[model samples]
Target: MKIDIAELIIVEGKDDVSALKRAVNADIIITNGLGLTKERLKEIETIAKDRGVIVFTDPDYPGSKIRNILKGRIPNCKHAYLNKSEAINPKTGKYGVEYAKPEAIVRALKNAKATVQDGSENYTLTDLVCWRLAGADSQKRREALCNHLRIGQANAKGLLNKLNAYQIPRAEIECFLAEYERGER
Candidate 1:
């Protein structure tokens, strides 16, 4: 069934917003990871109260983390995880749903699942880091301090200066990232 959802996609950067707009007709909002402040949530909640709001994000670790964060702030905000295979190339593994082809984008929307809503669910800093690493490409250097860790390439470099190393090995970290990317765990 085709769900004509008039949802808004909250993303971490302009590129994400642009890519999503190109692929879908939904409204796009860029949070810039300021942690969904009270005012922002209020604005989002106001919109969601009447219409369905689907929080579409990158199919990486950070994307999921963003969903979790949004869940805490916005009521009636549904979440959708993009199918990495359909939205991205499994071989080259260039991450992000924007990389998805036309048909792939259609399939992604068709297969989108409802976001599980729960108030008490909480994610730790470690979880955020893991999400960032998982969202990264396999061949890319797993720099914990790299800006591109989570918010994505457009924003990663600037944030990199503010991040600290957690002693996460490139390979081990990639494995953790892979679990989410491949939807295995």
Candidate 2:
């Protein structure tokens, strides 16, 4: 399926550009991994202000770091999330958007979430613990929450920051936790 996206997608590398080309017809900017310079960021800012941006980084630490940086610089940027499982290259055991199937890419792009710039503190670390997103044996739950919320996986603190940064309401989180409990039970 071909998607016509008006905003330019910001990815980590050329491989990601290639993968996205197969899934949709849209303009893309390559950040060359964590090597994003101020000049490049300026260019990205220009494009983001003019046409908007969708950040589609890899599902790894570096990817999260890059996404955070972009979010800090460009508020209200859209985010496309692909699960780590979907991004794993079967042959190399590496993870990246380039390794994901075109269909998965299409799905992620279609469901991209826009950042909510509203300064609402809707959650705390205690909420993360209560939701099984922190403490021992929480990795699985954290991953599940990330997938459900489409926010990408992160450690407890990072998850809390993302939850607030995206302005996810406490009620929504409660619903997800309730559903997760039901599924686990």
Candidate 3:
């Protein structure tokens, strides 16, 4: 199906933009994950405020971070985490949705939801960040967070917000893993 360009803002890399252009007619923007400039952010913010901004980032850490950054900046930006399952070479785990077929993109958007937030819980940011970086089972991650932080699900979410606000270092992800593992016993 052909998607119209008038209402959606497609956020992706240049190649993804190219693929998206080929797949459907959409207003697309490219961000190389170096973060957006204030001017660009403003333009995007303005467009997003008035229309729909669909964040179509690569399914990886940097891409995930870009989505997170945009969530904080864009007022009405909706995010679509491209399913790696849709890529032609799905097992390679590479970047860019350029390799994904048009059907995959469409399916992803159809199922896309509004931004997922940590909400107004009392948990620390560290807990949330750790949970994300752990690459463990969700039940395991939540259990670990609860066990280590001694906080309920409500507070665990707040911890995630706090961590995001503080800008946790990527290098320190290991520290969180260590702490979380230690707390398991």
lDDT, candidates in the order shown: 0.55, 0.84, 0.61
Best by lDDT: 2
Candidate 3's TM-score reads 0.54
Worst 10 residues of 2 by lDDT: 113-122
Which residue window of length 10 is worst by lDDT in model 3?
A: 114-123
lDDT of 1 by residue, 50-169 (tens): 445677677788777878887877756766666777567577777775676655554555565432233222333455455563345622433432433342343343333223212224
**Can you list the residue pairs that collide in candidate 3?**
123-155, 123-158, 123-159, 124-159, 125-159, 125-163
Q: Report the candidate with higher TM-score, 1 versus 2.
A: 2
lDDT of 3 by residue, 32-87 (tens): 56567787777677667545588888787777777888888874677766766665
After superposition, which runs of candidate 2 have C-alpha atoms over 4 Å from their true positions? 113-185
Candidate 2 per-residue lDDT over residues 79-114, each given as its tens digit = 999999999988899999999999998889878843
Where in model 1 is the C-alpha error above 4 Å? 1-5, 33-35, 89-94, 113-185
Which residue pairs overlap in candidate 2's backbone?
A: none
Number of backbone clashes in candidate 2: 0
Cα error, candidate 3, residue 27 (Å): 0.6
Instruction: Give all TM-scores, in the order shown.
Output: 0.49, 0.60, 0.54
Error of 2 at 19 (Å): 0.3
**Residue 1 miss distance in model 3 (angstroms):** 4.4
